[model samples]
Target: MAAGAPRIFVSHLSGVAVFDPAGDQVGRVRDLVVMLRMGQRPPRLLGLVVELATRRRIFLPMTRVTAIQSGQVITTGVLNVRRFEQRPTERLVFGELLDRRVTLTETGEEVTVLDLSVHQLPARREWEIDRVFVRKGRKGSAFRRAKGEALTVEWTAVTGFSLEEQGQGAESLLATFEQLRPADLANVLHHLSPKRRAEVAAALDDDRLADVLEELPEDDQIEILGKLKQERAADVLEAMDPDDAADLLGELPTDEQERLLSLMQPGDAADMRRLMSYEDRTAGGLMTTEPIVLRPDATVADALARVRNPDLSPALAAQVYVCRPPDETPTGKYLGTVHFQRLLREPPPTLVSSIVDSDLQPLDPDADLPAIAGFFATYDMVAAPVVDEAGSLLGAVTVDDVLDHMLPEDWRETEFHLDEEEVATDGS
Candidate 1:
């Protein structure tokens, strides 16, 4: 690293605010573009891919950059508003270089690259790769011993890496994604090429993949699902919320949907079938079949135990439904619900039925989106039980599902670009 040279890890530069010389906000750094060259030289920083307030991606050439600081980047006031399109020779540091595998020249050992450090070269206005941070040892293997702490090697000391190769880069990518929230992971997945996106999705566990799939746009969800094997796809669907699974299935061709559903477990398939039978905008379509349910005679302790499940969504865990025998949903008679707050206040031995909120009538499975929304708003509840005309507990509609239906059809495709101050203040 050069003395007095401002150095930043590639990961930190992502989402950093970009401003013009006048101190006016421009956009945020979405990615760093670089061009690979022959020989032992590190790739030179080409420019930046900036995402503006309009969600349009534009390029900022390195020549325009005046300063690179901790949370913000300064550029010459002049900027081309033209949307950025990748050229054949250009690659993204954040998108393509990070999380790749490279060989350490000293040890000839393969390590997954975690991040790259870049700095401006002396006597020149250009920035070049400075150091590479890499993690060694087999990924996801508990028995594998660490090869010591991550090594920060000079870029010149690494070799044998290329993003063009399939399966070589995914291990490191998924390792980093394991720490990201599903929404954030989905955003990164969305920006990747279809091939890379599928590769990353294939490496994720069923549960993690399900969560990311739910957060993605419908087209992306379908594309990833298509890439998965029928059996694996079924497993992923089974892991997702029944409502989300049904929605995704409904978007597929009827024959393809049937084929995938047939591969799912009978119980999960049945739940998906029931949810898929309703209109996309109806309560039944927006409900999850796995909400915590308890027998009328069950004690508060039992209800508390069920709500404590780590897999349960916060809204679903906020309350437990009290129902009559044949406890599996659809067959169970809807008695009432026990709010978690009530359970917390009551003695452990108290029967859940005794404290059930009978005044809060359950919504009919066929209830429209507006009606379902009103029910949640009126009761000030994050979730409400859905019942058939026979008063059988079918599922529970969560506020998130209801809101998804209420929002614009293309809401998932919408990009939310945080401003400079917001990114600086955000602790997460």
Candidate 2:
């Protein structure tokens, strides 16, 4: 749902059909995953549990959900088919919340929860439980309860569902720090006790855990990856950026690396193998295999739409590569690039090929860190493409990855301390 969308009552979403961007049916909504906060602060809507055609259930993060309209859930078409596993801090709206008994703040009368309404906050993507539909009647099952005074009340008007202050565990901790950036969260993990860090890591969803793992120190990344079950570890690895996954896998013993690589999708495994074959400090090792790739005939509008994908990092989204046939990396012919700024200036219908900047020479896959750094400095580029001798567009290296290799080993290991005042101010 977008900003200013209507509040959707949970009762309507149950068993709703879910479709992909292409309008192909992917699954049906089974349940919603929410993170309940301390007090009656309104639980954040995490995502939904979608049951696929294969009778397998998957966790579809709200970030991937593009629309919830006409009793159908439309996704961005980028889905992780892994089974949904409820986290320690997560609550199932249908299974656990409905039919529950609670008191109204205004009348002090007990009411049974018939349903809950959720809405995306205006100007933000975060969705939260907003209101409660309850009945002021007896304590029987909500469906069978004799209809009495039924009304919708503000989420704060009800009590009993929110987490309490005392004896809080990982769930509460996750809810409290929910708004932290991946880097900030990784820093938090770095400072936590091993047990606590493992608990927190386990509680995070695959996509989220993959992101946090990317930002963490190498040792911390390995430790967290090691703690997860082998199957889940493979899933997390597949979810990660190809270069980062390769880097992590390269750190393991040959046997361990092969085991994880074997479990990953063939294409992903191939990318990892290709990356691992390169010297760690070279362009091939540093570049991400999955930059936005489009054909010469693609329009500026098409490029812009690709850039808008939430999954792409800012660096990766800065520009798009226009190639010949075979749009994927190792594409047909390495055509020039079209910077995002160029796309914005051109009319929507303008072909990307016309605005392609061929002036900047591409990087060789074997280009060393210093050489790649020189190219970035000379061209003032945030990212640059790498092409093979066959003129195939291999991948692109972003400045952040360049810095990761160039900077001192301890650069990301800063001791992040939140003073009492800072903690109170931001509720850290």
Which window of ten consecutive residues has the lowest lDDT sum in model 1?
Answer: 419-428
Candidate 2's TM-score reads 0.90
**Candidate of highest TM-score:** 2
lDDT of 1 at 231: 73
Candidate with maximal lDDT? 2
Any idea what lDDT model 2 has? 0.87
lDDT of 2 by residue, 78-175 (tens): 77787788777789999999989999888789999999999998755678999999988887653664668899999999888899877547776777
Query: How does candidate 1 fare on TM-score?
Result: 0.60
What are the per-model numbers of colliding residue pairs?
Answer: 0, 0
Query: Candidate 1 lDDT, tens digit per residue, 1-428?
Result: 23367777888988999998888898999999875644456767878999999999988877678788758899977666657767545678878887677788988888888889888777555677878999886432457554645879888788964333233356546544445788878877777777778777876656678999998889999999999878778878977988999999999999999999888877788888988999878888888888887898899999998887556789999999988887888857888989999999999999998999998888988899889988888889999999999889998999988877778867755644223332211111
